[model samples]
Target: MNKTRSPIVQALLAEISTFDEAAAYRRMLPAGCYTEPEFFAFEQAEVFSRTWICVGRVEQVAERGDCFSWEVAGEPILVTRGEDGEVHALSAICRHRGEIIPCPEKGRALRCPLHFWTYDMQGRLAGAPRMGDAAAIATLRETVRLTQLRVELWHGFIFVNLDPDAKPLGPSLAKLEPLWAGYEATGVIDVPPAMSDTPLPWNWKVQVENFTDAYHPEFVHHGTHDFAPSIMPGDGVRFTDMKPGDNAIVRSVPMKTPDGGMMKDGWGPDAAFPAIATLTPEQRSRVTFAMLPPGMTMMFAPGTIAYTLIRPAGVTATYAGSDRVTYGGWLLPRSTIDLPDFRDRCAAVREGGSKIWAQDVPVNVGMQAAKNSRYLPEGIYGSLETTLQQFNVWLLEAYKRADQATR
Candidate 1:
């Protein structure tokens, strides 16, 4: 096995070297991780393909007879729910002539329109017309089956892994189960998922970093951002940074609540939905964001819980709802409470989300353009940028693991 690392990969390793908590927080990840095509391809195979990649919610295909077709980076995928009450992901390419199946095709079986080959919901061959003799048909059926991905559902999120032997997704996110234990799993309905995709001229990781890093709000979102009290470094509010191998991050900030009390609190309870009943006093007092990498973030607060539907586009871009997905804004921020029966409240959520997302596009695309610039500078993460440092650490570790596996 080839154990040597590519210059690009080696550059990444050295850039994101593990540092002490008090160490200067240099932009640990290399700029090339976003700009170089080769590095992106490595991530595609090593990270996206092998890891438990979050695609979308099971609500996308809720009906028992429904199926959804997907294509990412030329790899055709099909997800369907069988009558047996199970969801499955399989290759959407026809085994006979390699034809792509149309997306979201319904019914019990996937019948390739071009050829008459039919496959059951579980992806087992059901029928193929006029294949000479019974022996030939049986042999083809015995050996041919759609490639199946390892899939698991966590808190209504559907994640699929190309690697057949990948670890269970639940255990990987063990640290998060308790933090979010307060949420009523049943009450959290799929509120008409708000999915948006826009082209970024920068690497997908930048979006991931900017989302949870509280430091950026001081400038990037300066005037337009009205919801959260804008905070800057040396403001006496220190965020907790994660050590290597940490899968999540949580930080509490001091804010004045609308109830006329000067206490650390969440986004104003009035503008937000009702708090999850089970949240403890501290949990309700502040906002928390948890991540399931290489790019999934879950934000928890008294009133709302948000997540991204990210999919990677390439070296310097992303297509949310699909490869590796996100600016945190339009990335599906749902209320912790169920949507009220009233349409106005739901409309408010939709309208507010649209406005915020509009403000994010220029910032993201500009960052993308800057990443490919004459002055590629390393950023120093302040105490407030702990989330960024933690995420970057996770990114580096994932790359190292992927590299080691290749070796």
Candidate 2:
């Protein structure tokens, strides 16, 4: 782990929380850092190829003998449940002729249709039906184990790494462990196939930057502010410098009605300004939001509940999926829950939120286009933009390593 940690990164992480003045920070960037083609190429080769991406929900392959298959960065992967009942990630391609196995969803064994080769739940060669002799069978057994990838299960989320040599997820994420303590998440979770597609012409980073820009809430989510009557008419909320070692805490206070009572729907009279009802009473009491890296944002309100947004796909066009669950850690089968209807509700929430976000897409795309113009050399960010800076630094480091490797 120390080998992967660089001094530059250490220094940067230590000081980010105390940094002030978004304008001074903007001067530090070289021109075209956000919109250039070279950066995009590096992202595809280095970042997406080597990292453990959260491609799907944990429940997708939760049961023993269950499996889920998906492709990432053009690589086919099969995540399977072993006989021991632990989930494992393996390359979906058969060692022979590179044919894909574990086709068409979860299955007891990974069987290749092209050659009739079979691998057990653990990915060991179970049977090879043809061309069998003493030497041939020995050769087949020795070479046929499915290529394994690093997999980690944390808080009911599944992550897979394409680089077999990458570090396990736990140690890399150790710094964030303390922040998640005590949040109630539904022990059961799922990402329904139904998802809204908001195709933004803007770069992926632009979309992420928007997620952290809470300063725009009052102005951009105007519908929310306009319809609700309790919020103050025009208070522009701004988050200040976010410190690295600072205890994970939410910053915004839920808006209260002029009458000074908690609003039923968590919003003030101002349609856009919602009383920060999203936080658990405990978390709201503390005022904190967990800014997870490599593309996940979470908001928790104490014991009440929590929501996480994960970027399953890579930067070109990532899929933002959320899990709203409790910390109780209950494990009930899908049949026990009204999964379909629940999925519909989740879809509706995301779609509604996205319709609001759609308004920002053009602004972001125009910003991306301006990156190439002499007019926008670099741009300023605010305290609410702390996560924005964190993301850029992370992106730069990922690029630096991959760049070094190529050289």
- Using lDDT as the measure, the top candidate is 1
Candidate 1 local lDDT, residue 241: 43
lDDT of 1 by residue, 12-102 (tens): 6555544433333466555677788877877787777767776667887798867776544336788778667888888888888988755
True-vs-predicted CA distance for residue 213, candidate 1, Å: 1.2
TM-score per candidate, chains pooled: 0.81, 0.70
Clashes of 2: 35
Identify the runs in model 1 with alpha carbons over 4 angstroms from their true place.
1-25, 71-74, 192-194, 223-246, 249-255, 258-269, 321-341
Best by TM-score: 1
Query: Per-residue CA lDDT of candidate 2, range 261-372, in tens?
Result: 1122222342221223332453333323444454445443322223444443332444554322111211222332454554443344344445555666666767667766
TM-score of 2: 0.70
Over the full model, what C-alpha lDDT does candidate 1 score relative to the true structure? 0.61
Residue 188 displacement (Å), model 2: 5.4
Off by over 4 Å in 2: 1-24, 27-38, 102-108, 171-179, 185-188, 191-200, 225-280, 284-291, 301-316, 322-351, 372-374
